[model samples]
Target: MSVDVYLGLSAIDSRRAVPRATKCHVHLAAKPFVVVGYHLPGDPGAPIGLLCGTRRERPSTIVVGEPREAKLRLARLANFAMDLNGYAAQFMQTPTTSRRALHTHRPANGPQLVVANQATAQWLCDVMGRRLRYLRPDGDRPVHPGLPVAGAHLSFFAGQRVPGSSLVLPLTEILAQHWVTGQLPSLDANLASQLAWITDPGAVAEAEDALPAGPVPDPEWETREFSDAIKAYHQLVDAHPTRADQPMTGTIHDALRPSWDACWQALDLLHSLPPADRARDRWTQDVYQWSRHAERVRSGQAYFRKRPKQLQVFRYLTRLERLTADLSREMALDDPLIMAGHVAAGEALSGEVVTLDLSGRRPSLQVRPHLPFPRPVGTDLFWHLPRSTSPSGPAWPIVRLTTIGVTPEGLITLDVTAGAVRRDRHDRLPQPGQQVVFSPFGPRDYHPDTLPAELPWTHAEDDDE
Candidate 1:
């Protein structure tokens, strides 16, 4: 009878084992063949075997073929042996020239190899003993010695003293077990799930509503998304030069366009509001301004190095105006009072000058006003004298007034001189105490004391210097 043994997903040739049993039976003449399982001892090169008890009454010469088929029978007979004196027969899928199996099981699953006859099992155990001596006494050392240790195993395996029979498990399962057992701390599942929702674009608006209304909108999530979109936009522009000029129609561009438009709309709405409304809507205004500023910077329209000082000054002035308007609304002050205060401040800032002492020389004089005025105070002011004109000698009389008040109708009235000059035309005469002294170089030395003292001459420094 042809005997067939089926292993899951694999087939083995059993013809050799069948013949050995039949010969044993025939030689003993009706004595039953006693087939026993055994394993070769040691590494593949030096396999030796030991006797196992007989399965029947016949004295049998050892037989070993594909070893997988005999595992259950050998273990049941109590006849299996490894590392003992017996007739050795070795059966391997591939021949082993060395004392050990040349290849190990693939890492994707694991290794499973067994020996079937008792004599072969003992031979395997004997051969493996020599190889094991060369290995660290600890069985934890790799089966294939001299190979570089895997990085995952290095920390636990290096210099470890391993005992015989202890298994060296693969790192993959060890790490997985550690994580599953809570040996490693993990993020709270509910918080992690909520954060995922918060990051989702569909849920960002709802998340924002859950947060408090601050001076500016909660921009953390929007900013990250906007930044990524901006990077992609720049990359697109760089990759295709014409894309810059083309209307942005791509998905990323379309998504960001609405945000940009919303920002601009907010800014415009804030700007259009009256001062009273702006005061009540300060939080909205702040958010709008912040968005506007960020947009200007992002668009490269307001680079710090590229913006002129004058533009910076203008922006500062505009900010100041807005703040003052807000304060006025808060204080419930009328428009006229606000305007008067602004004009008074301007006058106070400009009312000062220093006259250069030119008593001994040809009477060339220099006048420096402490603050810049929009235009010259008089059409025929001495400093405005013709550049090509000649000047007289050393002590020509010079009149310098530090403060001159101008009426809304353009009347130039000096607080010190107490004299008003109708300064509507270039040929207007200088009033008393406002003598224009001419030198060869032009208007020169002047006596400030000769003018009236009632002028607002609040000098930054005293003349005693």
Candidate 2:
């Protein structure tokens, strides 16, 4: 009995604006028709399916039961193949055509190619090898008619093709083993380039270990460092060269590139900063003199002259103040002025009877008089009382210290209310029901006694006072 396979390509869904097309290749014999959704049927007609190029529209189905069914299936297959070939030609000619055009044209008596059964498909593969090409309707092009289409039944051939044994291996395990053992040449040069950009040495090592040993070209780690590595990583992501959307190497590169660049920038910034105060002092002095001169002009009688120039001077002063503030904060120093070389000028007045030495290092006294008191080593905790609740209603000194504590465990305990007090030890932490005041560093126990019942200082009743 002669057996014929009828292949029809059609879209998977009917509702899409353009349906997604797939190819169903069905085999038929003279007897009853049988279709196998999972396994290849033993009977006359069994559909060994292979999806053709993806389409934006639904594809027509092929029926292969009786003579009429076979003729109809053959005709549909022939039309589909011819339409696919024509679509491929059009796509090659004008690449920018709308996806709707993918299935717009139908061919007359579409071409038919005959194969006996699944074995014939494999035999054809062996005979044609890489030379085999199929008219892919959905892709709108010709593609290698290998396992993706021909012998797609290999996935179904699992248990039936193998000799009867008590144990049955899964198709995935068999394919994985074949992939590991198979001597396929290294990936194409373009693919290799993509791997180089996206795959790290560590990931490459893992992939290599999973597969059978092969010639792994050295990963040029040295040459790829610094700027080149960043550029290559970005290129890999942009091109998306992998057949699989979520290739392991692509994932590794995506994660590593940004983190590596950030580390590089951080290192560069650290290297830019001075290692010692001596180096910092030189930069500070130049900045300080520029700032002071600008400040003097703004405060003096010359402030009103050259208003535009004064604005510029004020801007410069603002920048200098910010720089000085940043340096002081970073260095954890009381005063940045000590590094501004102001101390050196005071030494020259040593011989004078009324010599004034401004050499002593001190915290900025702009807001208060310099008091001869021991400096505190910890944070000066304070709070900004909301204006509405304050005695004077919206006034200064609304800022006041709510509590004081040692530097190390400053907020181990707090008295938040007029009479209530809460205590916390390293071992005995406060629970949810207990009111707690949270510090920027972490949570703290709120002591009710510490909190003032109301504003401590009352506002004067009259505005004249």
TM-score of each: 0.15, 0.15
lDDT digits (tens) for residues 388-462 of candidate 2: 434443321111112223224222212222111222211122232333221111112233333333333452134
Q: What RMSD does each model have against the real structure?
A: 43.0, 34.1
Model 2: CA > 4 A from native:
1-51, 56-60, 65-70, 90-465
| Candidate 1: tens digits of C-alpha lDDT, residues 1-465 | 111122101111311111101100000111111111222222243111122222222222222221233442132212322211121111111221221112121111111112222222232333333223233223753333221111111111111112110112211121121111111113111111122221233443353344211111125533554345335546665677455322222322333233233222222322332332112233232223323333443353422222234444445455555555444332222122222232233331222222222232222223232333334443222222222222331222222233244456433333222111222221322333343321112232232323232333552235588
Compared with the true structure, model 1 gives a TM-score of: 0.15
lDDT score for residue 347 of model 1: 30
Tell me how far the alpha carbon of residue 363 in candidate 1 is from the true structure, in angstroms, after superposition: 27
Supply the TM-score for candidate 2.
0.15
**Residue 206 miss distance in model 2 (angstroms):** 28
**Which 10 residues in a row give candidate 1 its minimum summed lDDT?**
20-29
lDDT of 2: 0.25
